[model samples]
Target: MTVYLEDEQQFFEKHLGLLEKVEAVINQCLDQEEVPYEVEVSLTIVDKAEIQEINLEHRQIDRPTDVLSFPQIDPECIGKINWDNLDTSSCVNYDTEEIILGDIILCDEIAALQAEEYGHSLEREVCFLVAHSMLHLLGYDHMTEDDEKNMRQKQENVLQCLAILR
Candidate 1:
């Protein structure tokens, strides 16, 4: 997996250690899920205001959230992608031969606050958010109670596998 990370907010500069850990969490998720295609994910860290504007524009949610995921492929397409028959010759960046997974936007301000509220380090909170967003990118959703439970369990397991406990 290739993670193209950008920090639009300066908050992440102080917590540089968390960035590496977050990337590892994403990679671990993809590997554990046995994703057949080489994947590329874009991750951006923003402040609360920036994330709030994005949330409002994209999701019609006026409030800021810790993380948001925008998937590139349809949920059904994700499951049906034929890795063996995939013709990467026409795809952009075919040299890398990676399927563009999607984008993950994270709110550093919210993450920091949640870390304090949840009584955990910022590292853990960021890792959790990354893991959660990675699942979303992979067509996971929490619209129903059962679905939410399953997604939550998956996120916790991924975090645990990385030894990123609360």
Candidate 2:
């Protein structure tokens, strides 16, 4: 899997260790779910102002969310997608065997605030956000209680594998 990260905010320190940790967590989640290793994902870290602008432009919320996931797979095209159960065979390319997962945008400032409110480290909060965003990229939606439970469980499992637990 390939993770392309872009940091537009200066609030958090961008380090190789943090990037590697996030990558490791993503890899572990894919491995556990038996997803293909040829997927490509993009992660963008922005500040509250930037994220709020994006939110207003895209979602019309006019507020900054901790994370926003832009899933490439549309429901009609992907067909009955679920995060907990992934089908790698359906995602394989004819030759390269690669899958374009999707893109995720995270507000670093909001994440930091949430981390403080949740009484956890920034690293843990960021990791959790990444994991949650990844699940959304893979076609997870928490529109219902059951769906929320499933997605939350998957996020926790990925974090636990990375030794970043609640």
Candidate 3:
């Protein structure tokens, strides 16, 4: 797995080993889901204003969000993607030959606030957000009751696998 992580904030304080842990968590998700190819995901950390603008533009909701996922998987393939027979032309990078999974945009300000509010380290909160967005990229959504339950359980399992605690 290749993760292109960009922290847009000017004064971001990064935790040691955060990127390593994040990469591990993402690989764990793909392993658990049985994805059969190498993948590349882009992650960006932005400020409050940028997130709100993105939320408005993409979701039509004028509000800042914790994280946003833009999945590359076709809608028709959602919940039914054939791992063994993915179409390389549509889903892969020509140069890298890695599956283009998706993009994740995280609000650094909101993550910090939520971390303080939830009484957990900023690292844990950020990892949780990453895991959540990863699930979305994998075509899992929490739109319905059962879906929400399943997504939550899967998120917890991924976190637990990495020993990332709340």
Candidate 4:
């Protein structure tokens, strides 16, 4: 797994250690899932204002959220993907020879606030957010009750696997 991480917020400049842990958590999730092909994900840490703008533009929601995921492939059809016979005409990254998994956008301000409110460290909250977003990139969603339960369980499992406990 190749993570292209960008810290667009000044708040994260002093938190490089936390950022490295977050990256490790994401990589661990991919490894645990036994993903076959080489994958690429983009992670961006942005301020509240920037995330709100993105939420408005992409989701038509005028409020800031903790995190957002933009998946390149549909989750429902993931099982049917023929990795060996992949047609790289559309989704392949020529330079890296990896499948473009998706993008994850995180709001630094919101994450910190949630960490304090939830009585956990900022590092834990950010790792959880990254784990959640990674599942989304893998085609997980919590739109229904059962789906929510499953996604939640999966997220927790990933965090647990990394020992990033609450």
Q: Give the winner by lDDT.
A: 3
Can you give the TM-score per candidate against the true fold?
0.89, 0.83, 0.93, 0.90
What order do you get sorting by lDDT, best first? 3, 1, 4, 2
Per-residue lDDT of candidate 2, residues 1-166 (tens digit): 7777787764336544777778887787677666645787888998888889989999999988999988766553222455345565665455666676788899888888998999998889989998888877766789888889988898888898778866
CA RMSD per model (angstroms): 2.3, 4.0, 1.7, 2.0
At residue 49, candidate 4 shows an lDDT of 96
Q: Which stretches of candidate 2 lie over 4 Å from their true place?
A: 10-16, 75-97
Q: Sorted by TM-score, highest first, which candidate order results? A: 3, 4, 1, 2
Candidate 3: residue 6 Cα off by (Å): 1.9
Error of 4 at 114 (Å): 0.3
Q: Write the per-residue lDDT of candidate 1 for residues 1-166, one digit (tens) a residue.
A: 7888888776567876777798789888888777777788999999889899999999899999999999775565433444456555543357687888889999988989999999999899889998999988877888888888988888899999989998
- What TM-score does structure 2 among the candidates reach? 0.83
> Once model 4 is optimally superposed onto the true structure by TM-score, how far is the C-alpha of residue 152 displaced, in angstroms?
1.1
Give the runs in model 1 whose Cα sits over 4 Å from its true position. 77-92
lDDT of 1 at 12: 60
Tens digit per residue, CA lDDT, model 3, 1-166: 8998788774244566777877888998898888888999999989989999999999999999999999988544435566666677888898999999999999988989999999998888888998899988888888889888888899899999888998
Best by TM-score: 3
